[model samples]
Target: MVFTPPQNYNEIKSLLENLEAYINSPEFHEIDSLIKMPIIHYQFESIHPFYDGNGRTGRIINMLYLVQQKLLDIPVLYLSSYIIKNKNDYYRLLQEVRTKDAWEEWIIWMLKGVEITALETIKVVNKIKILMDDYKKEIRSEFSFYSHDLINILFKHPYTKIDFLQKELGVHRNTASSYLNALAKHGLLNKVKIGKSNYYINQKLFNTLTKR
Candidate 1:
């Protein structure tokens, strides 16, 4: 379905202003955040204010609104993945809202996305934490240079360079290179050279992050 938004600049601006006011208004504040969040997302997407990136901006607004309502400590819960997985339903339900005034189905679809995304995010976070702890224990047992900072830097970058380690750990360049080489020898990291620069890959962490 083709959804034509406001063609006039002033009309778009005025509508967006009203949207912002509604977000902070007492009427909106009274609604439960779970219910209001979907409404806010629908309204923002319907606005289609910018020439481009309206969908991306709308998703960002969803995270920010959750933060504002104290539903999330950080913007880690993303519904984009869920929406992408249900792409056809996502678009169909959105269009139904306009064509048939099917608000209930649209709201239910958004809430389901929220629930699935949140659960997946929690699982990923827990997995990362467990992997980090395992790495810390193994590295400490195997290497004299083991530090929590070293573990953090490895997981933080997944693919790291000698320069990154040198800067972050305030160590000499050669010292950083030696540390990385040692990890490679111990099978803790995979070392690769590309165009005169060597990089260390935390394969386990990389796998964990990229796993479906």
Candidate 2:
């Protein structure tokens, strides 16, 4: 979605340009903040900047804006997952914003998602931290230094390919493979082939990420 854009659209370039101008302004979000997050969110969605992936991109922007405003310390708020569940209402409200300029209702919906998503993310972060602590305190030291680093990196990216590790950790590709392989040996990871790429997932991290 991020890479594949929609067909030619007049609003796409204008939206990106507006977003660039907004994010770049030193005092930009001050007024946005005063109106509260919902208006800002409605505005983002209403702007509908990209030719494709506008919904996903707008959700990403929402999360980033929360972090930028210090409303969140992490980007774990999966607001889109909720919006996906209410896709009909999401689209309906967006349409209302477009047709009727119904700012209040749109903003309310966004703020509600913020509150709900914030609570949900807190629960997730707490569980992940607990899992992280357990792993840090109890994992055997015999797994090697690479294994330790790989486990930690998995907390950031639950499943990763060798390229991500090589670039992020400044390790050789084989070294990254060795690290992931060690985790697989320890029964901490399951190796999976995705398309042409092989990815390793720390089982513990996946459990936290995919928990009910």
Model 2, 1-212: lDDT tens digits are 12223244666666657666766577665666424555556656656555568678777777777777786787667688678878888878877876788877877787777778778878878888998776665455555463566557777777778898898888999988887787677776789988988888777777777773
In order, what lDDT does every prediction score? 0.89, 0.71
Error of 1 at 80 (Å): 1.6
In candidate 1 the C-alpha lDDT for residue 121 amounts to 82
Residue ranges of candidate 2 with Cα displaced over 4 Å: 1-36, 141-150, 160-182, 193-198
Residue 122, model 1: lDDT of: 83
C-alpha lDDT of residue 140 in model 2: 51
**lDDT (tens digit, per residue) of candidate 1 on 1-212:** 69998889899899999999988998768888888888888888888988999888888999999999999999988788888888899889989999999999999989999989888888888998998898889989988999988988998867999999899999999999999999899888999999999989999888876674
Q: List the residue pairs that clash in candidate 1.
A: none
lDDT measured at residue 47 in model 1 versus the true structure, 0 to 100:
85
Best-fitting candidate, scored by TM-score = 1
In the order shown, what is each candidate's alpha-carbon RMSD?
2.0, 5.4
